[model samples]
Target: MPPQVVEAMQRPMVPHRGPEFSEFYIALIERLKRLHRTEAEVLLWPGSGSAGWEIAAVNLLEPGDVVVAGVTGDFGDRFALVASTFGADVRRVELEWGNAIVPERLDAALRAAPGAKAVLLTHNETSTAVTNPLAELTAVAQEHGALVLVDAVSSAGGIPIEFDAWDVDYLFSGSQKAWMCPPGVAIVVAGRRAWERTRETGTHRFFWDMDRNLEMTKKGWTPTTPPISLLYALDAATAMIEEEGLEAVFDRHRRLGDMTRAGLGQLGLRLLADDAYASNTVTAFFPPDGVEARTIIDRMASEFGITLAGGQAHLASSLIRIGHMGWVDDEDIESCLTALNDVLESV
Candidate 1:
């Protein structure tokens, strides 16, 4: 977490219903809207990015609605499953684990399922460390007259995501990832068309209701008691980003990503993602010969006090993930690389 974010959290707490809290909430949301580059309503929830996925499903989809889901990695597959679990008839467009979602393939899938309510895609597949070509894919989906829903949890704060300019109908992200905050908040944006659709065919909804969230937020409130301290942290993080300027922040992430990949290459490790599609927030790499991914991750933490993440599901034992998002600097990257070098030599 950023130092300012931690400091903000350490401040005194205020009641959720009080005027101070309400003012704070509104200010935070406004900053978030600017960050998202959307004039539409942005909803905040006391939940995780997974909760944002559920909100997208429950609010925008009805039973038996056709949904075109592009599954390129774990988070993508999980979003597809969320739609199916919500009773949507999901037409899955599969991609290889480390590959990106091909726009032409998505276009063809949308053509086949002309009546798809929405084309669901993950902007950054953290599990595979690949960032999909979102603007192009959204254009294809729109050309087919289908709404575009994006899972941008891992990309929003680190990369540029213009919700309105890109014509995304629904988009969701977490406060944790690149927002430089701890978990417990989800940010969701619904475009005008999506809001209209919600009014026309709103699914069974209660707590996660976007309509309710919008109304409450307008009045400077939330449907339920939100995680106040987390909100404070997020507010501070957003300010810090604004202070640095979004362009600079984005540039810094890109530079760190390049540094990490090059460092890993020099160490004779292999990146799982292609250079063109590599995620700015994280990089997934295959461990060296005769070494387990978890072994290096553990060794890095124990030996150098540097933490690293391992791949999920099928890639768990095969790859390691280095997260360069949120509060990460060149020194942090160098420390992680140095630790990996030591571990690789020993193991």
Candidate 2:
């Protein structure tokens, strides 16, 4: 976390029901709305990004409802699972793990699964380091008259998302990724259609109820006690984002991604995602011919004190992911690349 975020979190607490807290909550929601580039209703929940998936499923879907999920990686599959758990018949458009989902494929899937209530998508699949074409995919879903729910957990703040322009029905993200804050808060943005579904759907929910959250939010309060410290951290982080300008922040992430990908390529390392669909926040790549992913990760940590993530599920042993999201810069990417280069040479 950044120093400002840390300092903000360290400040003393305030009464959750008081006017001061209400004002703070209202302002934070506005900032979050600005970040999302939407005037839609934004809800704050005390949970991780995974909770956002459940929130979307429980509130918008009923038993036996057909939901089409574009499964590109682990997160996308998890989202489909969440919807299935909530009794939605989730028909997944499974793609290769390292590739982004194309619009034509989604359009075909929707055609096959007629009367699908919603389409679940991951804006950026961190597992594969691929950013899906959200706008085009959303357009296709809309054409099929389906509500579009997006998991923007890894891309929201780092990547440019025009929520209103795309007519996205619902989108959610967590505080830890590009928000530059500690984990705990799940940020949800819902449009008119999603709110309407919440009222008509009979999926049982209490804590993740969108209706109750909306009622309380109008009064500048949350239905339950929130993670105040994380909110403080986010408040500071959003201010920092505002000061830096969203366009500039996005440009920096793009530059960092390009630098990391170019450096890895120069070292003869292969990126998992194609250049056209590569994520600006995280980059996934394969290890050298004989080097193990774990060996590279361990050596990078033990030698240079730089921690990297291994891939999920089936790709666990073959892929390594390097995060270049919030609180990162050109120098940081350069350092990580330099250390990775050394680790490969020594191995």
Candidate 3:
């Protein structure tokens, strides 16, 4: 259950090519910088995180450039596949689907792929509800002097990701997840090293071009017209995060995650992710013996008005996923848990 954020729905739209929009755009970028904990440039594009994946590819990598990718879940696999389609050599460090990427394995891959120009990782693997050891993996990347590009779609605002401290050269997130806003914007934040790499990148990307955004961004605008109302809503929503303080925002997620996991324990459910690798945004649970995940999810929704997220890929019907991202809290969690308990009892 998402918290009541009625203000976002009521925000007035403005002209995307006008002065009013420019002021909002510039301020929103600075505000996003605080959210990202970086001094790097933040680019806003007219696509989902899917587009951010390719933007990262075209902006910093030309054909034949090599990168080491971490494959822990579905999105991680897709990111590597996207980079490969762009003509980059994709070397992967594969891990069990429900587990986080062990830094040692990545270190080995880096050692093996010395020509690797970048390392791609998902900060939170939504498909598995596991938070990768980004701080550890990026540290290894820095040791090898390789740029780090991160997909933080599911974990952006809910989980802590310090772009500067982690030395992640490229980071991108979508608005729909933790932002609790409508989808249409792909936010990409790039560090100085990643920005410089763009100069040597010869790939052609017109609309998803980060360089054009970088230029327009300096003047309080964008390369193309943006979703002005969604920008207005993002301004309203993410600003609320700042008012609550980032630390408290993260704690809210942790508290809810802890409580949700505890509730799952009382229900005799199994968390798909290992405890140490579990995420604060979402929790994936393997269905108990003889329980149908799809049936339970259907019952929880159709019967109880509780809408929980579902798993991806092979785990789709094998696990029940509860999204505790964005503005979820104790009461909302209690409601979901109660619905879950009711549905489980009948199971």
Q: Which pairs of residues collide in model 2?
A: none
Off by over 4 Å in 2: none
Predictions in order: lDDT: 0.90, 0.94, 0.88
RMSD to true structure for each model, in Å: 1.1, 0.7, 1.4
Q: How close is candidate 3 to the true structure, as a TM-score?
A: 0.97
Give a tens-digit lDDT track for model 2, residues 189-261. 9999998888798877899999999899988899999899999999999999999999999999999899989
Model 1 has an lDDT value of 0.90
- Over 1-347, each residue of candidate 1 has an lDDT whose tens digit, in order, gives 87888899987989989999999999999999998888888889999988978988888888899999999999999999999999999999989888998899998898899788898999999999999999999999989888898999999989888888998999999889999899899999899888888887657789998888999999999999889999999999999999998888899999999999999999999999978899999999998888888888888888988878888888978989999998999999998888888888889
Which candidate tops lDDT? 2
Candidate 2 residue 118 Cα shift, in angstroms, is: 0.5
What is the TM-score of each predicted model, taking all chains together?
0.98, 0.99, 0.97
What residue pairs clash in candidate 1, if any at all?
Answer: none
Provide backbone clash counts, one per model. 0, 0, 0
lDDT of 1 at 176: 92
By lDDT, the better pick of 1 and 2 is 2
| Shift in Å, residue 101, candidate 3 | 0.6
The candidates, ranked best first by lDDT, are 2, 1, 3
lDDT of 3: 0.88
